[model samples]
Target: MESDDLSSLSEKKLKKLINETQDVLDQLKAELKQRKLDRQHHEIDHMEDYFEDAEHNLSNLRLFIQKVFSEIRKR
Candidate 1:
Protein backbone atom coordinates (compact mmCIF):
# COMPACT_ATOMS: atom_id res chain seq x y z
CA MET A 1 0.00 0.00 0.00
CA GLU A 2 1.15 3.53 -0.71
CA SER A 3 2.08 5.63 2.33
CA ASP A 4 -0.44 8.25 1.31
CA ASP A 5 -3.28 5.71 1.25
CA LEU A 6 -2.21 4.22 4.57
CA SER A 7 -1.92 7.64 6.17
CA SER A 8 -5.56 8.31 5.32
CA LEU A 9 -6.79 5.29 7.31
CA SER A 10 -7.82 5.63 10.95
CA GLU A 11 -5.61 3.89 13.53
CA LYS A 12 -8.16 1.16 14.20
CA LYS A 13 -8.60 0.51 10.47
CA LEU A 14 -4.85 0.41 9.96
CA LYS A 15 -4.45 -2.11 12.73
CA LYS A 16 -7.20 -4.24 11.23
CA LEU A 17 -5.57 -4.09 7.84
CA ILE A 18 -2.26 -5.18 9.37
CA ASN A 19 -3.89 -8.14 11.11
CA GLU A 20 -5.59 -9.21 7.89
CA THR A 21 -2.30 -8.96 5.97
CA GLN A 22 -0.53 -11.07 8.60
CA ASP A 23 -3.22 -13.72 8.37
CA VAL A 24 -2.78 -13.95 4.58
CA LEU A 25 1.00 -14.18 4.95
CA ASP A 26 0.65 -16.97 7.51
CA GLN A 27 -1.73 -18.91 5.25
CA LEU A 28 0.61 -18.53 2.25
CA LYS A 29 3.60 -19.77 4.29
CA ALA A 30 1.66 -22.82 5.45
CA GLU A 31 0.58 -23.63 1.86
CA LEU A 32 4.15 -23.29 0.59
CA LYS A 33 5.45 -25.54 3.40
CA GLN A 34 2.91 -28.20 2.51
CA ARG A 35 3.81 -28.00 -1.19
CA LYS A 36 7.51 -28.30 -0.39
CA LEU A 37 6.88 -31.45 1.64
CA ASP A 38 4.75 -32.98 -1.09
CA ARG A 39 6.95 -32.45 -4.17
CA GLN A 40 10.01 -34.62 -4.84
CA HIS A 41 13.31 -33.04 -5.83
CA HIS A 42 13.65 -35.26 -8.87
CA GLU A 43 10.26 -34.16 -10.17
CA ILE A 44 11.33 -30.52 -10.06
CA ASP A 45 14.59 -31.37 -11.79
CA HIS A 46 12.71 -33.21 -14.52
CA MET A 47 10.56 -30.11 -15.13
CA GLU A 48 13.69 -27.98 -15.46
CA ASP A 49 15.13 -30.43 -17.99
CA TYR A 50 11.95 -30.25 -20.05
CA PHE A 51 12.16 -26.43 -20.10
CA GLU A 52 15.81 -26.56 -21.21
CA ASP A 53 15.00 -28.98 -24.01
CA ALA A 54 12.15 -26.73 -25.21
CA GLU A 55 14.46 -23.70 -25.24
CA HIS A 56 17.08 -25.58 -27.25
CA ASN A 57 14.46 -26.74 -29.74
CA LEU A 58 13.13 -23.21 -30.24
CA SER A 59 16.64 -21.84 -30.80
CA ASN A 60 17.25 -24.50 -33.44
CA LEU A 61 13.91 -23.68 -35.12
CA ARG A 62 14.82 -19.96 -35.27
CA LEU A 63 18.10 -20.76 -37.02
CA PHE A 64 16.33 -23.07 -39.46
CA ILE A 65 13.87 -20.31 -40.37
CA GLN A 66 16.70 -17.86 -40.99
CA LYS A 67 18.41 -20.32 -43.32
CA VAL A 68 15.17 -20.97 -45.20
CA PHE A 69 14.57 -17.21 -45.61
CA SER A 70 18.12 -16.72 -46.83
CA GLU A 71 17.62 -19.37 -49.50
CA ILE A 72 14.33 -17.79 -50.60
CA ARG A 73 16.04 -14.39 -51.04
CA LYS A 74 18.36 -15.89 -53.73
CA ARG A 75 15.38 -16.77 -56.01
Candidate 2:
Protein backbone atom coordinates (compact mmCIF):
# COMPACT_ATOMS: atom_id res chain seq x y z
CA MET A 1 0.00 0.00 0.00
CA GLU A 2 2.99 2.29 0.31
CA SER A 3 3.55 2.27 -3.38
CA ASP A 4 2.04 4.88 -5.62
CA ASP A 5 0.93 2.16 -7.99
CA LEU A 6 -0.60 -0.94 -6.44
CA SER A 7 -0.92 -2.61 -9.82
CA SER A 8 2.82 -2.64 -10.09
CA LEU A 9 3.22 -4.67 -6.94
CA SER A 10 3.92 -8.37 -7.17
CA GLU A 11 1.33 -10.79 -5.98
CA LYS A 12 3.52 -11.80 -3.05
CA LYS A 13 3.83 -8.26 -1.81
CA LEU A 14 0.11 -7.64 -2.02
CA LYS A 15 -0.60 -10.86 -0.19
CA LYS A 16 1.86 -10.00 2.53
CA LEU A 17 0.30 -6.60 3.03
CA ILE A 18 -3.15 -8.12 3.21
CA ASN A 19 -2.05 -10.72 5.73
CA GLU A 20 -0.42 -8.14 7.95
CA THR A 21 -3.46 -5.92 7.83
CA GLN A 22 -5.69 -8.83 8.75
CA ASP A 23 -3.51 -9.62 11.74
CA VAL A 24 -3.74 -6.05 12.98
CA LEU A 25 -7.50 -5.96 12.47
CA ASP A 26 -7.88 -9.20 14.37
CA GLN A 27 -5.89 -7.82 17.28
CA LEU A 28 -8.07 -4.75 17.39
CA LYS A 29 -11.23 -6.87 17.48
CA ALA A 30 -9.82 -8.92 20.34
CA GLU A 31 -8.90 -5.80 22.28
CA LEU A 32 -12.38 -4.34 21.87
CA LYS A 33 -13.98 -7.57 23.06
CA GLN A 34 -11.72 -7.75 26.07
CA ARG A 35 -12.44 -4.15 26.97
CA LYS A 36 -16.18 -4.77 26.74
CA LEU A 37 -15.89 -7.76 29.08
CA ASP A 38 -13.81 -5.75 31.53
CA ARG A 39 -16.36 -2.98 31.49
CA GLN A 40 -19.15 -5.43 32.24
CA HIS A 41 -17.20 -6.99 35.07
CA HIS A 42 -16.53 -3.60 36.55
CA GLU A 43 -20.20 -2.74 36.42
CA ILE A 44 -21.14 -5.98 38.14
CA ASP A 45 -18.50 -5.62 40.85
CA HIS A 46 -19.78 -2.17 41.81
CA MET A 47 -16.37 -0.73 41.10
CA GLU A 48 -16.80 2.52 39.27
CA ASP A 49 -13.94 1.60 37.02
CA TYR A 50 -13.33 -0.04 33.76
CA PHE A 51 -10.59 0.72 31.24
CA GLU A 52 -12.21 4.16 31.38
CA ASP A 53 -12.27 4.65 27.66
CA ALA A 54 -15.17 5.16 25.28
CA GLU A 55 -15.94 2.71 22.50
CA HIS A 56 -14.49 5.32 20.19
CA ASN A 57 -11.24 3.42 20.05
CA LEU A 58 -12.96 0.43 18.51
CA SER A 59 -14.83 2.66 16.11
CA ASN A 60 -11.65 4.36 15.07
CA LEU A 61 -9.93 1.06 14.49
CA ARG A 62 -12.54 0.06 11.95
CA LEU A 63 -12.37 3.45 10.31
CA PHE A 64 -8.62 3.20 10.14
CA ILE A 65 -8.77 -0.12 8.33
CA GLN A 66 -11.36 1.24 5.96
CA LYS A 67 -9.13 4.15 5.13
CA VAL A 68 -6.14 1.93 4.57
CA PHE A 69 -8.04 -0.39 2.31
CA SER A 70 -9.53 2.47 0.40
CA GLU A 71 -6.15 3.95 -0.19
CA ILE A 72 -4.83 0.60 -1.32
CA ARG A 73 -7.66 0.11 -3.74
CA LYS A 74 -7.39 3.61 -5.06
CA ARG A 75 -3.74 3.06 -5.84
Off by over 4 Å in 1: 40-75
Model 2: weakest 10-residue lDDT segment is 47-56
Model 2, 1-75: lDDT tens digits are: 445688888899889989999999999999999999999887878643434455358887998999999999998
Deviation of model 2 at 62, angstroms: 42
Please provide, for model 1 over 1-75, each residue's C-alpha lDDT reduced to its tens digit, 9 standing for 90 to 100. 899998999999999999999999999999998888667665776797878777788789999999999999999
Clashing pairs in 1: none
- Measured by TM-score, the strongest candidate is 2
Report the error of model 2 at residue 60, Å: 36
TM-score of each: 0.52, 0.55
lDDT of 1 at 51: 83
After TM-score superposition, the amount by which residue 20's alpha carbon in candidate 2 deviates from its true location, in angstroms, is 0.2
